[model samples]
Target: MNLTVLRKDFLAGVVVFLVALPLSLGIAQACDLPAFAGLLSGVIGGVVVTLFSPSRFAVSGPAAGLVTIVTGAVATLGSYSLVLLAIAIAGLLQAAFGLLRAGRWIGLIPDSVIQGMMVAIGLQLVLQQIPVFTGAETAAAGELFSPACLSVAAGAMLILLLWQQP
Candidate 1:
């Protein structure tokens, strides 16, 4: 492998680690679990995926997308142990699907649909961070278009534009 490419990948990994570390803690808190659980999950996920996953570039970390599902599962089951059991079963099912080559079916999805989903997820993340950008305690409908929020929104857009330049 080229040293330049290796260096770039290493830098990217560092960035990912920095971002994933706090996110893992936040995700665990959202699911009403101790912060250490999130750290442990991240470590295990990294080790397992790195060793077994076919895709070398696949990312394995605490996902913001699963926060609601985890919270709901914990609430419905009334115990963390039940949620752990459910996760283990789900993982086993996924392994079975992988062995069956079910993952290849995902390649059948159209690029446009996948791009649209990515855009939607990006928008959702920005919407969720509106309150933080506006220095508000909560992101209420009425507060969404306030002067502070608008200014922050404009600044964020500017930063995104600048960051996207070659």
Candidate 2:
């Protein structure tokens, strides 16, 4: 309500947009979907989820964890339209589960299983991004690695490492 609160909220929104925009675009690229699809989904998901969620600090956006499954779904379904239909059905099912208060059962899941799933997701993301990192499409058969691509990747990694330092 106050000016300070408004400023803080605006800053938070900008930070979230900066992080979420590229994540959404990368997820769409990973799934072999159009870039616009990712951008639209990210915006809609963030707005709708933030508006309807009970939690005041919920950050709902396109999930990086779903990249592998989404890619497989698009491939298997052989159409993005079919994948979209499936996603709609899944959303309905999720809403039904929420209404039924099935979230209470989530505590039954083991921590090790959850950790393993996280590790798997991380591995899948790295593996999926390999081609993009190497510029696989542009490189010839005898020359797979591009110096520029490798330099960019190394710089990105260094930045990520430095980001956690302080």
Highest lDDT model number: 2
**Clash count of each predicted structure:** 0, 0
At residue 65, what lDDT does model 2 achieve? 88
Instruction: Give each model a TM-score.
Output: 0.62, 0.93
lDDT of 2 by residue, 45-156 (tens): 9888988899988988888989989999999999989999999999999999999999999999999999999999999999877877887766777888777887898899
Q: Model 1, residue 38: displacement in angstroms?
A: 0.9
- The candidate maximizing TM-score is 2
Superposed model 1: Cα runs more than 4 Å off: 1-9, 104-166
The per-residue C-alpha lDDT of model 2 at residue 142 equals 80
Q: Which lDDT values do the candidates have, in the order given?
A: 0.83, 0.91
Give the Cα-based TM-score of candidate 1 against the true structure.
Answer: 0.62
Q: Write the per-residue lDDT of candidate 1 for residues 1-166, one digit (tens) a residue.
A: 9999999999999998999899998889767888998998988998899899889788888788677678789999999889999999999999999889899899999999999977776676666566666757555665654567668778988999889855
What are the C-alpha RMSDs, in order, of all predicted structures?
Answer: 5.1, 1.4
